[model samples]
Target: MFSFIIRRVLLVIPTFLAIAFLTFVAIRLVPGDPVEARTGERGISPERLAHFRHELGLDQPVWKQFLDYLWQIAHGDFGTSISTQTPILTEFTTLFPATLELAICAMLFATILGIPAGVIAATRRGTFVDYTLMGAALTGFSMPIFWWGLLLILFFSVDLGWTPVSGRIDLLYYFEPVTGFMLIDSWLSGQEGAFSSAVSHLILPTIVLGTIPLATIARMTRSAMLEILGEDYVRTARAKGLSPFRVVGIHALRNALIPVVTVIGLQVGALMAGAVLTEYIFSWPGIGSWLIESIQRRDYPVLQGGILLVSGIVIVINILVDLLYGVLNPRIRHAR
Candidate 1:
């Protein structure tokens, strides 16, 4: 297991380099010039434009620029943002925790609801329960997150006033950010209503962000369970007069978790991708929204760094998932 983890960790370096390189190239390929974009309509003089380009090192050859970027990154520098002029890495660090919080909550929401729905559907195959659950999964899978967020806002926030329309917490509750995760920090602060305010603000976005993952997990779970249920071991367990709960929960569910785990891992990546839309709709300050702003400003450093950071996170999660497979089924670890 240690060797497996080391190997996976080693692989992440090359993968990250590839992603970083691609992001660098892609951002440069985009037509807008960051200097020009920053200066906008009544632009600067030719000499000023040239000075700006040189100052940003854009005047250098592409190879030198990339090498410099690599060198900077290797030294733990992500450069200054073209727009905000903040250190890209610092900006990323500040925003990433919020995105992480949202993704974690979204995953929790999905896993809590999706797995059981799937198990029930699989066990009750061909029945009304199966059809109803599966149908709901399909709807959730197909629903647009932005639209869903808006609808949730309309119903829960605008109409019922059950939840806040947007933001991480109510502005009324002033607490210093310690951990960066509002939910935890709120509780840690011991301020009145802080925790509830954070949760209230999180509800709509979490549901919107979790919907597709929940649907995907449910479908995958149902499929995996269906297959596992027919396996000889399951039959043997049933024949041995194991209780329904033991047969399904212990025997069937554990075995079926491999595929479900895969879906859940992939859903982490999906949540990051989906958070852009969900965050925008809810006005949540996270990396996703930050990335969008960077693009608008043609902030190449932030764009490249953000993409690299996000991809790195996704890759790490996937590697962790691979490790989990070994734990889930020892056969896989032994095979490796």
Candidate 2:
């Protein structure tokens, strides 16, 4: 198990470098100059433009710039944002808690409901319950994040007025964010209706963000459970006069979870990607919105560093998931 973990951790170095290089090059390839973006509408003199370029090191060759970038990253400097002048790491830490909170809520929403839904669908394979649940999952998986988010806002916010149209919490409740997570901070504030307001604000965004993950997890769980149910051990458990719940839940579900957990881990990337659209639509103050603003302004440092950090997080999570595989199924560690 230790060796398996070490190998996975070792693999992250090359993967991180590849991601950093690709993100550096790809953002640069996009049309628009950061200097031009900064001096929008008013424009600048040729000498001024040259000075800005030189100051930003854009006057250097691409290879040199990349090497400098690598060196800066190696020294734990993500560089100041060309547009905001704020350190990328500082901005990310400030905003990331909001994204983390939203992502956690969305994943919890998906996992809490999706696992049971999948279990029921698999257990009643040929029944109407299976068909209905699977159909719903398919529909959810196929829905576009932007469209779904809008429809939800229109219905819940506009027509019914059941939820806030956008933002993390009500503007009426102003308090220092000790944790940066609105739900927890609001509760800690001890103001009337603060926590409830936070929850209300989160509802539509969470549902929209969680929909795809929920569908994917449900389908994967169902598939794994179905396969596990037919395994010899499951049948043996049943033959040994164990209860149906123990046969399926204890025996089949445990093995089924190996693949389900993998799918769940893979969903982190999807959730982050989806958060961009979800945050835009809902106006959530998270990393997704921050990245979008940076892109619009052609903030190269923020774009490159933000993407690199996000990718690093995803890579770390996936490595943790791989380690979890050894815990969930001892055979995986033994095989390694």
lDDT of every predicted structure (CA atoms):
0.91, 0.92
TM-scores for candidates 1 onward, in order:
0.97, 0.97
Candidate 2 Cα outliers beyond 4 Å, as residue runs: none
lDDT of 1: 0.91
Q: Who wins the lDDT comparison?
A: 2
The sequence of per-residue lDDT tens digits that candidate 1 reaches over residues 29-52 is 888789989888997999999999
Candidate 2 lDDT score at position 89 = 98
lDDT of 2: 0.92
Per-residue C-alpha lDDT of model 2 across residues 68-169, encoded as one tens digit per residue: 999999999999988778999999999999999999999999999999899999999989999999999999999999999999989989999999999999
Name every residue pair that clashes in candidate 2: none
What's the C-alpha lDDT at position 7 in model 2? 86
TM for candidate 2 is: 0.97
Candidate 1 runs further than 4 Å off: none
